[model samples]
Target: MSNLPLTSNKLLSTLSSSDYERLLPHLETTDLPLGQTLYEPNQPLNYAYFPLNAVISLVNILEGGQMVDATMIGNEGMVGVPLVLGTMQIPMSAVTQIAGQALRIEASIFRSTLQGNGALYSLMLRYVQVLMGQIAQNLACIRLHSAQERCCYLLAMMQDRVGSPELIITQEALSRVVGVRRAGVNEIVNTLGRAGLIGHQRGKITILDRAGLEAAGCQCYRTLRAEYGRLSRP
Candidate 1:
């Protein structure tokens, strides 16, 4: 109901005027704090969130209760896609990995608007495609890349999504996201810091040199980035 600019969320900003107007009344702006659980596995989703600056991580829980990152959703896409697709449940857990804000809409209203098969539906489908692509690429990267390379890849991806060089995340969180041990994460962080690619202090990571980080990362980083750019273009 807020007439605030939708420009922060690219997915919403791309909606045609008519489609945007239809969904505008139902939209409410909200903040997403770090560690906020948007939804749990197999639970009904109550709302669909279009992130303005927040980054949500979709994680798969292993049998032993370890959480491995599946993919991350930022301003380029929406959370709660299961609701839009007519299913209220998702197998993975959704959490706010970064503290920021977003625009949200009730699940039922979002579903009805999506059922119209208009621009929102089409755009969301494209977003899903990109999401799937990134997940698949991550799978391969995890399998074939070294821990250091994977760390660089994750940092690069997060930098692009958040549109900032400085990230306020703990090493433990980075380890979980990269599916590596904390020791390994520390090693990678130290390596990057020594190379002048990044500065790490406390829980913050500042990208001192973007080009250097990209060069240290695996090819999957560039590949997924190019795919996202190509698929998500208006």
Candidate 2:
């Protein structure tokens, strides 16, 4: 898996071979545990992490202490965007949403290397744009969609990030991410379960009806995919 194309990630893979090789030496493989905070709100970022299999969530904590995931990053993208934007501090908190591995690079090193006209810098910029589109769509979804629709969208997004039908998460944690109460989440979960769209046991959720889930989601999911496709540019 380590030897598989670093380009498996659209951002890294889009780089020219020579450019990728130059940065390859700096990429260090590391394990990411579930719920691990990569960066706290308003904190300085130390490194940029490119997931090989991990999923990271960018969450916003409101003044009232309410939390919701603004966007998600996975093997298709990288974390620590502040590094590329010429800042060390992040406004939102980043945390590992799933247990997996990633390629990490020091912020200083990445910034220095990315300077000047280079494929790496271009790829990073495009990825950031794609990420912004996802966040914007999610913001709208949360405002206009039903809790059940948002729940389906969230699960579909998670499945895409992890490339698995089963997700290991709890109602309490999910409530925080979806910006809903525990009871609301439980009610939706129970509805989906009874309809045979999903199966939940303990903290694990298994998607049983992919078609049904897609039907249940708002336009946000498709919007996210379209934006990524536009930025990825094959």
Candidate 3:
């Protein structure tokens, strides 16, 4: 597991022994269903999730009801980060993109645990910094990169998080992640499949060649991975 955390979540693993011990009692193991919205725009958060295998996306909803993923959170990080920073509400929605396990804690209790300027507090602050950098890169990729390149980057990231070559993701989810239409997603995935980078059929996508997938993706995927690598290092 990542950094030998009690759970697979690297953020939990990176916490100091005392810090981990203090929160262990309150952390509950839960299963997140795919497409479940953890929190919505301006909605008060109740629990923070430290995903062990589950992948969550922080999606920003536009005025016309279009949704774009700001960034994806996996075992590398936690949802409900704003609570630790004294903000109770967020403009984006945190939705579960993959169904898997997570260690969940009540937001109030979690906030109380970070009362002082301690190791956990410092660690989360750094994690937030890494997350911000990742979101920035993702936004840039969406604007400057092709749909095929962005799709490759997103699939590669999701595969890394779930530790599986095969992914159970819907065309709807693909459209949301790539900020494209359903027809566009079909076109992009078809191209990737034809090139042998990935095999997409219905709701499941199988990575046929990991190296080839990365080769097809833009540099943003590698950049995000490097940024997350720095988070666990702290």
Clashing residue pairs in candidate 3 (N, C-alpha, C atoms within 3 angstroms): none
Q: List model 2 lDDT by residue over 1-234, tens digit each.
A: 344345556667667778888998999888888889999999888899998777898988898987777878887789988888889999899988877778899988999998953677877888888888778777787889988998898888778766789888878877866778999999999999999999999888999999899898787777877777776463
Q: Over the stretch 156-211, how does candidate 3's per-residue lDDT look in tens digits?
A: 99998877898889988988888899999998988888998888888899999999
Better of 1 and 2 by TM-score: 1
Better of 1 and 2 by lDDT: 1
Give the 10-residue window scoring lowest on summed lDDT in candidate 1: 1-10
Runs in model 3 lying further than 4 Å from the true structure: 1-5
lDDT of 1 at 126: 84
Cα displacement (Å) at residue 211, model 3:
0.8
- Clashing residue pairs found in predicted model 2: 7-13
What are the clashing pairs of model 1? none
- RMSDs, each prediction? 2.4, 2.2, 2.6
lDDT of 3 at 64: 95
Model 1 residue 4 distance off true place after TM-score fit, in angstroms: 8.8
> Predictions ranked by TM-score, top down?
3, 1, 2
Worst 10 residues of 2 by lDDT: 1-10
lDDT, residue 71, candidate 2: 78
